[model samples]
Target chain A: MKTPVYISHPGLVTPLGLGVQQNFTEITNGNIAIQKHSRTDIAKEPFYAAMVSEAAINEAFKSHGAISEYTKLEKMMLLSALETLDNSEVKISDKTLLIVATTKGNIDVLDKDSAFNSERAYLPNLAKTLGDFLGVTATPVVISNACVSGILAVAVAKRLISSGGYDNALILSGDLVSRFTLSGFQSFQAISDLPCKPYSKYRNGITLGEAASSVFVSTIKPTQFAVQVLGDGSCNDANHISGPSRTGEGLFKSVQDAMKEAKIDAHEVDFISAHGTATIYNDEMEAIAFNRAALHGSLLHSLKGIFGHTLGASGLLETVIALEMMKQELILPSTGFDTLGVSKPLAIVETIKHQPINILLKTASGFGGCNTAVVFKKVS
Target chain B: MRNGALFAEIDAANFEGFLKQLYVMLDCKYPKFFKMDTLSKLAFMGAELLLSEISENSSEHKRTALVFSNRSSSLETDRKHQEAISSHGEQYPSPAVFVYTLPNIGVGEVAIRHKLQTENAFFVFETFEPEFLQKYTVSLLNENKCDQVLCGWVEVDGNERHGFFYVVGRNGKWKHSAATIKNFFEHD
Candidate 1:
């Protein structure tokens, strides 16, 4: 209980805007990142994606110095992590544990005829590459549990720091949104022609996006930050390998467990960061889950509207965005929302602003029925 | 609570012995679900043996959750799934073979048998990272989404399977501890 894991600082690079300050201000102003996807020839499917500008990615690598070929997904990782380290004024070293969260590390590189070794798809190799880039040879632990990877990474880093294994742990999450994911999601038919609209009526499918974020979690008790990770829960639906449960039963238990862990009631949550992918089933299931859990947040939204669905990066990426939202005193509007979809009468953030963030519930679900929820309270 | 673990080892010679060991463990339950019919079934068999009586109850369909990780992600199933697509045209592959493509789906099958309408998640790592295993397990436990977590490392190669499980508790608020392998692989 003495482990004061404070989010000293956060860094992010996404389609919305690069740099933590830029994104934070935009999030406060309720800016959205929806844009038509670049290069639509492969499947040629009509869809929108919140794509990061190549100029921003190039600038990130330049600032980090020449990234070696061995470092898979280093481009995105360095961009976000460096931003965090710079913002937090923390130095990276052997003493700092670099915990990376990702699903596909470098599968994108392997797909193309790249010069680097294609075998970086494995876990340890990918970890080493990331650690090497940070000038820390200490083994990086990569958590690859489909979409809920951010909370998964947080869980891992929290244990290490709280257990006195490391002085500081960097929770970095990103996805190298590859042709594989696009093709796979396309095959599953989970993509929407229009931008994804979560939790509202006339909601379409999800639009995929990419993000890399770094959060400096330390055992320091700071009285100023807006939020802290009070509790977290993750469970496998065990219902279907590829599809989510019809009842959202797994998500219910996860929320219940997280609340029990946090020692709070459902009514205490001021806002809920739902995993509203805008898919017909995913949205319906979440709507059903909220009603069954009897959980209501004063204001609710899915950052997927702003960042698209960053897949594995969605959990932490959205969580990081939520923290920034807390700092900015805003509850972001759910972008791409048109009308109400489910009968739950839940307050889905459809317009451009909701305010005064205090206690928030964040949830994310993935393939293999992986569902996770984490509670963050404003650390005043 | 120091739980006494039952470890049953099986090789070519103790194949029948393994079956008998499983039978005794099942406690008069129907033996058909213990589908140790082939070399491909060792993980299913070994995991079944490890769970002993806990897995054979009437609540086998949905009440139970499967949490497993491995280096070899269904090599046997992958070869067969590929063969079906290759032989019977790419579009018309066997649904039975195509279904087990993910390493975590076996848990769903076990849940379908148990009625475990709870949280089930699968982790894929190079070798089991102790920090990842302990933290992830504790998170699920602390959340109270899962009553008993069957966290383990299960490996299968040819006719051999080596796997272990530790049924741990999250209710104690062991949220963020860098638990050692003893905490993860050892119970009691």
Candidate 2:
């Protein structure tokens, strides 16, 4: 029999709040964090984004280390990972692996007036900084596959631990809403003018968000609220460089493979945490993929409406929230969703439904035509 | 260049020119080759050289995975995107340049070329960690995730470029181990 991996101690630092419980509370209370930001330094015109409060991050980071010494993304990652470390019995050692996931780390360092050296923009250096902060002896592995980096980190951790390469894995994922990403998204004309309404006909585009989330995966199970990493699949659309597949071919195959490995059928999945960025093509693509996987009737929700699109952090942050929902037996509504917009039908959670979520599917798709689906089961 | 015999060499003035010369020598007909950044071009060429030797069965292609690592993490293309939006330049970032900012686009390019939709991951490290790569790839094969894996270190930063790619399968002549992989990464 293969070794089973268990996940616990979810850590989060998002615009809603710090720590998993705080963010969960905010989401449960119908709070949305995406708002108008008129920062001239990041963009020429005002844009809507979910930004973590600098003051809050500094205040919470005071007990950890010097605030100014670390970059903004570093501070978020450090705080989130420290939460998981503080709560879990797992220790950072040679036997433990650290995986850092992000699209752009310390990207602000490339700005003309940045305080840090430009070399900090390199992902390996950024990961090493986090590893050094946490006193990890083994070389940290970094994943930078666009938005799927966060959830893909979980899948990587599961594989590494199952391979007996490590006793425990601490997965930390973070990204920033900096001038680089904001300008890039603006260039694509993909930034939503309003808070994104995923799967709604009136939805315009994605609302960029920034946050960091961490989770610990190990063979040892926590005393309470532990979830088993059943199976995972990541596949490329192999069709486009930047756009998702029009037919949702990659996502369909990913979900099918993941479920096949989990030895479960579509009817067994109680809920799905979807990657609904509210863009027209993305939502439509997801609808088709879910329908193709025979998951049209599965209860689904997108966390983007609450936290916006956290980029690298979105997948893990949303997964963390899904775990909490499983424990609480409450399925949060897909905020900002009104009418079904996609061609196929999706059982979008329109209201809070208190139901036992045994098996859940978490999926994320991103640039480079990458899609990842991971199946998790609540350990009773 | 087969078996390190140096069968061909191109005397070009610049890196791009050298890549173009190599493309012509290989007689590649793919029109999309011209649009890729330096990193993608290098990865595509390396993959072409390695994958061309494999069987042409389309069914086997779905069982092939690509695991790549790099040091720079698309910084060369990122520099261009940054410059386009910088105050000293045009201040208009092109979506075409912006799309190639992630390192995995190269992996995506190769996947599109070979129609391999199995598994893909791009890792960044300070240097090539052969042990980690070997362990990760072996686990994937052992777990029945894929039948074959294209693993390598593809790094490109401005004028510096290094690509080492090899296919790992159950029936390879050489044993798939860290030491052997390291030997190829260093000597080959």
Candidate 3:
């Protein structure tokens, strides 16, 4: 028999707030954190983004006096992981693995006029630093699989713990809103001028965001409300390098694979945490995929409107939010969604529907034509 | 049991030429390869080198998982993108260069080339972890997540590139064990 993996001790640091209670309250109240910023470092023109303020990070780190050696990205990840680990009984020893997921780590160190050595910008260095801070002796595993990195990390951790002798694994996902990332989105013309309207008729593009989220997947359940890691799958579109498949073939296959592994039918999925980046092609593609998969009846919402597209952190952050939403029995509205946008129809969660949400499916697709789907069951 | 194996290393001076030479040697005509960034190019070359002979009749191409890793994580392309912006101005960040900034683009490149739409992922470790790679692949294969795996480390630092790729399949010649993976990874 396969080992059961349960998710517990969720910790998140986003523009919405810190911890589950604060962010959940703010998001449930329909308070989105995205705002227009004219920072010269990011861009000369104003850009909309959900960014965690430096003051907030500094304030959060005030309790840790000996953190001068860590970079801003490392600090954010460490803080998020610490919060989650604090509530857990699992020891961070050789038996416990640390999986750090990010699209870019310490990327700012590569900018011109920066004093830090460029090697420090490597992802492994960032992972090692955070793992060391978490008191892990084993070498850390870093996942940099574009936007899917966050959710994929959880899947990897689940498999590792289930198949190996490890009893616990911590999966942390993070990315920063740096000048490099912002300008890259701008270059692609995929940056929305206003708050991102995911799955909306007027949706333009993604609003870049930054945050760090952590989840502890253990063989032993730690809480009554622990979420079960049902099954997961990842597939490549094999169609384009930067664009998603026009047919959503990768996404369709990913959902099919995940559902097959979860041993659940499409009708059993009570709700879905869609990627819903709000871009025209991406939303259309997802709608087609869901419809093709016969998931037309599943209530679905995207947290991108509230958190923006958190990139590497989006999958895990959205999963964490989905767990909280399930715990509170609140179907938070897909903020910024006004009218149906895609060609295929979807039961997009428009209002705060207070319905029982169990057996949730979270899906994410990224630039490299990568698509990932993970199934989670709410523990009663 | 394994059908074929090959390893290739490229230096900065002959990187482009080496790719072209290998492309002709393998008689490949994929035009999109020329557009890939250095990271993708190196990974694609490694995949081609290992799977050139054996992957021909494998109907389960879609079932082949790519377990790739690197330490640099696209720093070379990052530097180029940064150079493009700095050398040009603040208003000009090349989207083409910007797209390759992430390290997993290498996995995507290999997937697109080989039409591998399976359980693909790119990990960044401090160094190559042969045991971890072998264990992860074996677990996935045992779980029936994938039928075959193309796993290895493809690290590109500046002009120098080193790649070690292995095609592990069920009912193959080589055993998919940790020690065998370490041997193959460290061989040549």
lDDT of each: 0.65, 0.89, 0.84
DockQ of 2: 0.81
TM-score of only chain B in every candidate structure? 0.65, 0.93, 0.86
Residue by residue across B1-188, what tens digits does model 2's lDDT show? Answer: 54455747789998778788888888888889899998899889888887887886844456888899999999989888888878654468989899899999998999888887778999999999998898889888877879899886889986678888888988868998999988878886
Candidate 3 runs further than 4 Å off: A113-115, B1-13, B55-57, B88-91
Worst lDDT window (10 residues) for model 2 chain B? B1-10
First chain TM-score, candidate 1: 0.91
Cα error, residue A188 of model 3, in Å, equals 0.9
Where in model 1 is the C-alpha error above 4 Å?
A1-4, A25-31, A38-47, A67-72, A87-96, A163-166, B1-46, B55-67, B71-113, B117-126, B130-149, B155-188
On TM-score, the leading prediction is 2
What TM-score do all the candidates reach, one by one?
0.79, 0.98, 0.96
What is candidate 1's CAPRI-style docking category based on DockQ? acceptable
* Model 1 score (lDDT): 0.65
Q: Rank order by lDDT, top first?
A: 2, 3, 1
Model 3 lDDT per residue over A1-380, tens place? 89888888889999887787899889877799899888876677888999888677778887874555667777777778878988586566678888899998788888775556777788888888787677788888899999999999988888888897477888889998888888788889999889999888999999988899998898877656768899888999988888999899999998998999899999999999999999999999999999999998999999999989989999999999898888888889889999898998899988898888889999999978899999999876
Predictions ranked by DockQ, top down? 2, 3, 1
Residue-wise C-alpha lDDT for candidate 2, range A1-380, written one tens digit per residue: 88999988889999988998898888778788888999988887898999999899999999889998999889999999988988586666679888999988888898878889999999999999999999999999999998899999988888889988789899999989988888898889998888999999999899989999999989997776779999999999998888889999889988998898899999999999999999999999999999999999999999898888888888999999899999999999999999889999999999899899999999999887899999999987
